[model samples]
Target chain A: MDTEQQVMDHFEATCRSHGLKLTHQRLEIYRALLQSAEHPSAESLHKQLETRLPTLSLDTVYRTLATFEQLGLVKRVETMSSQARFEAKIEQHHHFFCDQCRQLIDFTWHSFDSMGLPEALMGVGTIRGKNVVVHGVCNDCLEKKKKPE
Target chain B: MDTEQQVMDHFEATCRSHGLKLTHQRLEIYRALLQSAEHPSAESLHKQLETRLPTLSLDTVYRTLATFEQLGLVKRVETMSSQARFEAKIEQHHHFFCDQCRQLIDFTWHSFDSMGLPEALMGVGTIRGKNVVVHGVCNDCLEKKKKPE
Candidate 1:
């Protein structure tokens, strides 16, 4: 099986193992993350989710997203911006923040597993264990600059 | 000169170079950061600074601390907690976060700079490069486990 399928299987098994009910809310949130390319804030996700699940509480989205983040199905990217952004890529990778648009793009095909931070670093709370951030303008932003005659 | 003195001198120089007026508020905030071992949240720093500069505004403390963080005179450590934490150790190093105490400690000896990330990882918007975090329990927590009554 391919990686995405494997990841889906893992999430399903994880939910079962944790005895977490795979409710409509959970499935909708997971599907939303799976479908989304933009690193969206919880508020953004809530707004998108409202169209399908009109009765969904913003608090429920936040709580469920937090749970998914803790479950390793999503990533929370830290920006200087007030709203927190999240991505669904589970594999090891880094991100680039568009300075102009403030969008985040996944810089894939990288792993920090061999980065060799000291053993003591592992002693803190559950470390996601690695961090990598790249910030700059995306190609779309660059293309926009070329648009003016 | 000792490290703290050297750091203080550097802080002052950095301020002068940046054309920032080195106010008592800034200096006191820097002093608190320099003297602190525990990575302090802005609230904690404000409380400490309030003792010395009785009329200092919490907003001023927050703003000044943010300015220092931006100038690289101090660093911010990401936490699961709501508030961001600051550390005085400006060198390229990892951190040890205590899950129970919500404490952040400096672990200065990691040499991950030589661990080359792949070229594909260097995409646009890669600003200021990368930082690595290896989270886990610290030695103190491990020791705390073995305590006998």
Candidate 2:
């Protein structure tokens, strides 16, 4: 099986192992995450999922998203905005945030041999690895600035 | 004048220039932020400032902090944590997050220009400069790991 299929199979088995009921809402949230190219906020996800899960409550969306975050199935995208967004990619990588357009783009560049975190901190919290986020303007934003005054 | 006094004077003057009412709550909040070595959350600031401003409502604390953030007197520290934290040091520098202690330690190795963050990010929502936050285990965590017989 391909990597995507392999991941899905694992997720299915893992959910079963964890005794989490795979409700329609949970499945829809998972599908919405998988389908989105843009890292989507709960509000965005709710809008997308509304077509299928018409009766879905906003609270349910938040709860489902929170559950996926806890399960390590999705990663939260950081923005200066109050609303939270998330991504489905689970691999070790970095992010490029476009300050102008408010876009979060994926960037893959690994520079560290290990986490290089200070040795003094551990057990206080579980930090699995580095989630390096680099902020800058994307190519589109760069082009927009070249327009005449 | 000392560096701290200079910063306070500058901040107070800036507040005046903007016609922002520098109430006791604002000053108390500013003092609390200036005193904190750890990038502290709104709740943390509220707790600290309350000791001085007993009549200060949580709403006032939040509003004062929001104002401080908007006035460029403080910068928001991004984290995966739910609550937002503010950095008192507005100068360009990176942070060393102690995952164990949940503290943000500032590391000023080089100027923002020296970091070489792409110029495209400039002027986009105030890309003051680049900061390389190295997330890792601190020295204390490493010592504890080796202690067990």
Q: On residues B1-149, what C-alpha lDDT tens digit does candidate 2 reach at each position?
A: 25888888988998999998878778888888898988888888888777677888888877887888888888888775668898778776666666665566676554333534444333443332344555666666667777954
In the range A24-126, model 2's lDDT, one tens digit per residue, is 7887788778878899989888888888989998899899888888888888765676678898887766666776777876655444324244443324344
TM-scores of chain A, one for each prediction: 0.80, 0.83
Give the C-alpha miss distance for residue A19 in model 2, angstroms. 4.1
Chain A TM-score of model 1 comes to 0.80
Q: For candidate 1, what is the total of clashing residue pairs?
A: 11
**How large a fraction of the reference contact set does each model reproduce?**
0.48, 0.14
In model 1, where do residues sit more than 4 Å from their true spots?
A1-13, A78-82, A97-102, A108-112, A118-128, A135-149, B109-111
Query: What is candidate 2's TM-score against the reference?
Result: 0.75
DockQ for every model comes to: 0.41, 0.24
**Candidate 1, what DockQ?**
0.41
Badly placed stretches (over 4 Å) of model 2 are: A1-3, A17-23, A112-127, A136-149, B98-102, B108-128, B133-149
Error of 1 at B5 (Å): 3.1
Q: What is the TM-score of each candidate against the true structure?
A: 0.80, 0.75
State in Å the error of residue B133, model 1: 0.8
